[model samples]
Target chain A: MALLDVRDLSVTFSDHHGRRRVVDGLSYSLDAGGSLAIVGESGSGKTQSALALMGLCGPTADVGGSVRLDGRELLGLPWPALQQIRGQRIAMVFQDPMTSLNPYRRIGGQMTEMLTLRKGLSADAARTECLEMLEAVQIGDPSNRFTQFPHELSGGIRQRVMIAIALLGRPDLLVADEPTTALDVTVQAQILRLLADLRRAMGMATLLITHDLGLVAGLCDEVLVMYAGRPAEQGPVDDVFARSLHPYTRGLLHSVPRLGRDPGRAPPARLQAITGSPPAAGDAGPGCAFAPRCAYRFGPCDEKQPEFAAVAGSRRVACHLESPP
Target chain B: MTLLGVEDIDVVYPGRSRKDMPVRAVDGVSLTVDAGQTLGIVGESGCGKSSLARALIGLAPLSRGEFRLGDSIVRAGERRWPRRLREEIQMVFQDPVSALDPRMPAWQIVAEPLAIHRPELNAGQRRERSMAMLDRVGLTADLAMRYPHQFSGGQCQRIAIARALVVEPRLLICDEAVSALDVSVQAQIVNLLAGLQDELDLAILFISHDLAVVHHLSQRVAVMYLGQVVESGTREQVYGLPAHPYTRALLAAIPDPARLELPAVLDGEVPSPTDPPGGCRFRTRCPHAIALCAKSPPPAVAVNGHHAACHRRDELTRPAPG
Candidate 1:
């Protein structure tokens, strides 16, 4: 069995706006040492996917479907039972390190506490290993950094600290949601390098959730492009990037301002902005969700939902046009 | 005659709280732009790009030196700008969501600048003119009735662009205008800005942290560091063939999937602005820091028309201190 397997996982919520399901029928698997990146726009439900895993989804998140870790069922596991798996077996590094880390606690204290609680190591031993882990993440002067609070460090240092904290106990799976978004351009490169290194060194399977395809193009092995709480396309990074089967994925990749492309020549951009807004949850009634904004939608796309079947060249797209491949 | 002549314009942020130290936000920056040319200002965050933009548009008071919009000097406490000056210059902020009045519709937001600049216009004329300006930014006339919140990040930016252009300003100061938008949206906005710039014949003081975006858009580039122009040159000269170490570092730092890693020249956090290093401010971090660096600030080492503040100008022309 794979290290972590999520089968038809769905997440819903109820508020003043009625029942809103953020994540619907999401399924992916990862072996012991693998990296999968889920890329999407702001409201494309990438963050919720990470939250769904490790049982971090809040009370309002009405979850259904199976979440398996090392062949063990986790869907309806009690909070106490799930808590044991979370942070110990699987860890998460949130987007913003400034808010994720406790400002009051010292880095050493936070790192040591996790080691002591999860792995039952002595305080002294935990401190030693944490300092070693900090070094592994390429944090300078790890001994001094241990005593420093979250606020004392720069944005990059703090993120490295967050990564170190996540890797303290060496969890089997790691879910990093836009870990480098808040960092400066220079620091972003450093943090990404660290994540890539540690993933290889520690033999940890990782799920990197971010918006920047450029970052994923270099770092991630497999790519999942999500749209309106569902995966629109899934395949190897090079394959998906080279031949984006879905129109939305192609539009997203072209939209990003890469190093090339003269900014001066104002070409009348051909953006497939999907004429309307994202379809709301429970609104995907019997038809393709993307049909509303799809530029090339024909009669068949609007009438029925498309299957997420395999396409040619080992790729899969959840669109009617590419379903036959 | 220079269209906009600013020489040695300095802005010092006097410490408000007792504990905080005074910060020299922008210091001794001098440049002149012809009436119909765009000058792109590129720098890292906290490099005083916004402060320079604020001074150029007469929003902030100059602590020292001179600022002239044509022949007239911009004086302190003249916050209520004169009609002729107000109509000629306008500023667009980074976040259109907060910069624009959310309670009012798009037409009213664009009309606010029109009313301020051309008070003589009646409500009917304002409405007509605002819709006309909206069309220039590639926005539909129907969007005039919708609120800013209803639009996407890109559309909200178009509304902001319309607001800036509605006054028919000669110079538009865009402070990270498209930085917040998505990449695809950024290209659209960039296209819109270019079309408007050409049609209206306006000068632009484009400010941004992203070097690649600046390289893509700007005609001429000026790199700033700790409230001063560390380097200035033509777009190809500055971005393609960089003069200053800081400029090269800024360009190298931007993530480019197309280009593999170049020899990186910078490391560590941005030095604190409050207590910037004495003499050459960048010396503390500059890889080529020597004994002379702590003694005096480096003068602008001249290129053909370009300039960079570095002691070892000869070294920059070489392999750039690998």
Candidate 2:
């Protein structure tokens, strides 16, 4: 069995407006030491889905469906049971490192606190493990960094610290939400490399949630493309990127300016911009959510919502056009 | 002729105390942008690209050097900008939502420039011009009555672009303007800016950390590292054959799935501008740094009509060993 298996995962929130579903009927699985990327733009519920998996979604959100790790169901567990599993079996690294970390506490204090409380390590032993993990994340002079507060470190360093803390628990799975979005291109490369290396070294499964397709290509083995509270497509990263059946995926690929294009030749004067914006949650009517902006959208796309079905080997697309003739 | 000429411009922020060091955010940078030309400045965070953009439009005071817009000249330490000079140079910032006034309607925000620069026009005339500018930027006439919060990120950027170009400024400085936007929306705005550049013959100082975006719009490119222009050349010259190690590193760092290979990551982070290393500022992180790199600042060497400030420019640019 895979290390992490999720089926029919759904998340909804009830506000003054109405009960709006943010994630709906999403299913995927990741084997031991495998990596999966949840790719989407803003309001795509990719982040919310990951939050649901971690049991970190706040009181406002209503999450459903089965989340199993090591043949054990996680959904609807008590607060204490969930807490025991969190940061111990399944760890998470958030997008913004500054806000996630405490400004007042030194790096050593914050990391050691988690270790002592969760792993039942002594203060001295936790300190030693913290230093080792810091060095493992390629933070130079871990000893000095231990004494410094979060404010004293750079964005990249703080992110590395977050990764080290996540790994200190020796978790089986790691969920990173837009880990490199706040960083520069060079720094982003470093962080991605660090994550890839650590995942390989520790034999851990990773669920990387990001908007950048380029990131998905390098770091992930499988990909789940989300749009407007639903899974638009899911498959091996190479297959999804190379032969994307969904119009949204194709539009996303065409939108980004790539570096590999020949500098000597003139680039396409205008990019294939996806006209109109993504629909607001629950604003997507009974029909297909992407029908409004989809270039290849047809009669059925507007009349009825498409269901996620197997299209090719290990690939599933939620598009009416993907149906075999 | 160059519509905008910047010579050895330096912007320095004063120290907090006598013991503290003042930061030289932009140091001895020189470049030019001709009429209807786009000069893209590419750099990482804290490399002073935004600082340089601010200095060009007189938002930040230059500690030294000079700038010329057409025939008019503005020297360093000039606190007050003449109205004519101010009207000729406009800027579009990165954050579209925060850059605009939330309380004001979209038309009012776009027409505010006319209110400041072209007061001779009546309120009705200003409104017409604002609506026309809005239409040109792809925003419909109906959006004119809406406020910033009502518009999407891409639409807000269009409004911002409309506001900047309403005055028909000789030069437009976009400091990471499309960085906050999504990939699809970013392309739309890029195309919109390109179209406006052709229509108005406006010189653009395009500052961004994204190499691909810069290459898409720029006629010429300048690569900044630690408050200095490490390399500057025509788009083809710089992008096709980068000379400076820093520039090469920046290009190589772009996440290209087509390439599908790990980038040659730089060794260390950018040093604080306040206490930058002597000689080459990039020596700390440069893979090609040698003993000579730490001794003296690298001279700008000219090759194939391009300039790169690196002691080992030739060696770095040489063909790789078989």
Candidate 3:
């Protein structure tokens, strides 16, 4: 059985413009020790979908549909029940470490408090565990760093501390939302490798949400490509990248400049840029959300939304032009 | 003479008080940009790429050295830039939304440069020029009345580019100009810049952290590390045969889906600039660092017209192990 199964999860916010659905009928599942990535551009509802699954969407958001963890329904759970599952069952690594961490408290103090409160460990026991967790995340001289505040450390170090704190409860699943976006390329590589290593060492599943398709290819086992809050394509990373069925996915690949082209060969005269921007939330109207920008958009794509259907082996794509042979 | 020639330029932020150490933001950097050519300055954050760009435009005071734009020689420590120099060089900043004024409409913002530099032009002429510039940047004249908030990121960036070019500056200094835009939008801006450069015969000092974007747009590339140009060559030489370890690591670090092979990751964070290491600034994180690297800075060596500041440049540039 899958460790986390999401069925038609939708997140809507009620404003003066009525209820606008930002994440519309998103569904995916991750088995124990599996990694899945949700790839999309800004305003694609990638972050909101992850928030909905974690029940972290605040009071204004109305999350619907079923989120089953180990075959237990998570939707409509009370505050106390959701709180218990939050850190203990699933943890999250946010985008910016500076804002996510408490600026006033020392790193050790934060970790110890969480350990004592969540795990019922004694104060002394929590201190020991905190030190171990810091070392586990590869922070050298944890004893010295334990007393330092978040501002005292560099951006890269602070991110590592955030990862350690998230894994303190030994959650079964970890959801990282653009964890490396704020970092430099060298620091980003370190963080990615650390996440991969820690995930494997702890035998936990990962739900990585990012905008970079290259990062998805490197870190994820499977990928769910979202376009304007809808899943455009989903399959194994290698298979999907090798032969993407959706025009949106292909467009994204074509736009990014790949490194290490032949030295003397000129780069493409011009990039094949997607012409239009994504639609506003709840304003996609009746047809396919990506039809405005999709090069292969057809008549049905303009008239009706295409449902996700099986394509080539183990892949599913939502496009009017795609069908299984 | 080169269109823009910078010789050993340095920018230092003096210590606020006795206790604080001076921060050398840009140290002894030199490069040239020919007419209708783009010289890309690539580096990670805090490596002083932006500071160098600021120095070139007189925003940051250069501590030493000299730079020439066309026939004029601008020395360090000049309190005020000449009007001719200011009119000849323009800059486009990274943040499109913040860079533009909230109260001003797109047309007024684009016309402001002309209003200040060319007071002889009447209001109608300024308006007509602004509309023409907007049209050149692919923004229709009808949208000129809209404010920055009304426009998307890409549209706002186009407006910014139009403003920078309306003065008809010979040199354009763009510091991470398209970094804030989406990938598709970024490509559009890049293509627009390339087109404009050719049409106007402008020289560009393009500073960005993105290696691929730099490679695509630049004719020559300079890799900066710890406020110094670690390597510089034609785009082909720098990208094809990087001589500096830092440059090689940076190129390798790019997440290329076509090349799934893992990059030879450089360990540790960039060292603090205020209290940089004794010798080579990147020695702490360099994979090929030796005892000599910690004793003295490496001198620049020329290899097939490429200049790299590394003690082990030859060995590092050799064909990689399988």
**Of the candidates shown, which would achieve the greatest lDDT relative to the real structure?**
2
Q: Which residue pairs does candidate 1 place in steric collision?
A: A255-B183, A255-B184, A263-B216, A264-B216
Q: What are the models' TM-scores?
A: 0.91, 0.98, 0.98
Superposed by TM-score, candidate 2 places the C-alpha of residue B252 at a distance from the truth, in angstroms, of 1.1
lDDT of each: 0.78, 0.89, 0.88
Q: Write the per-residue lDDT of candidate 1 for residues B16-113, one digit (tens) a residue.
A: 89988988888789877667777888776777889888876666666777667765677544565555776777888888788888899998988887
Question: How accurate locally is residue A86 in candidate 3, as Cα lDDT from 0 to 100?
Answer: 90
On TM-score, the candidate that comes out on top is 2
> Roughly what TM-score does model 1 have, to 2 decimal places?
0.91
Task: Please write out the lDDT profile of model 3 over residues A1-325, one tens digit for every residue.
Answer: 9999999988899988798888887889999999999998888899999998778888999998899999999988898998898978999999999999999999989889888887789999998998999999889999899999999999999999999999998999999999999999888888888898898899999999998887876778899999878888999988887778888888888888766467545577677788866666567979999888877777898899899877767889988884421
For model 2, residues B207-244, the per-residue Cα lDDT tens digits are 99999989988989999998999999998889888888
List, residue by residue over B71-162, the lDDT tens digit for candidate 3. Answer: 78888887766788898899999999999999999999999999899999999999999999999998887799999999989899999999
| Candidate 2 stretches greater than 4 Å from native | A322-325
**DockQ winner among the candidates?**
2
**Interface DockQ per candidate:** 0.35, 0.66, 0.62
Better of 1 and 3 by DockQ: 3
- Deviation of model 1 at B90, angstroms: 1.7
Q: TM-score chain B for all models.
A: 0.93, 0.97, 0.97
Indicate whether candidate 2 or candidate 3 has the larger TM-score. Answer: 2
Query: For model 1, how does the per-residue alpha-carbon lDDT over A136-221 read when each residue is reduced to its tens digit?
Result: 88777899998988999888888888888888767998889999888767667677777887888899998999877777866678
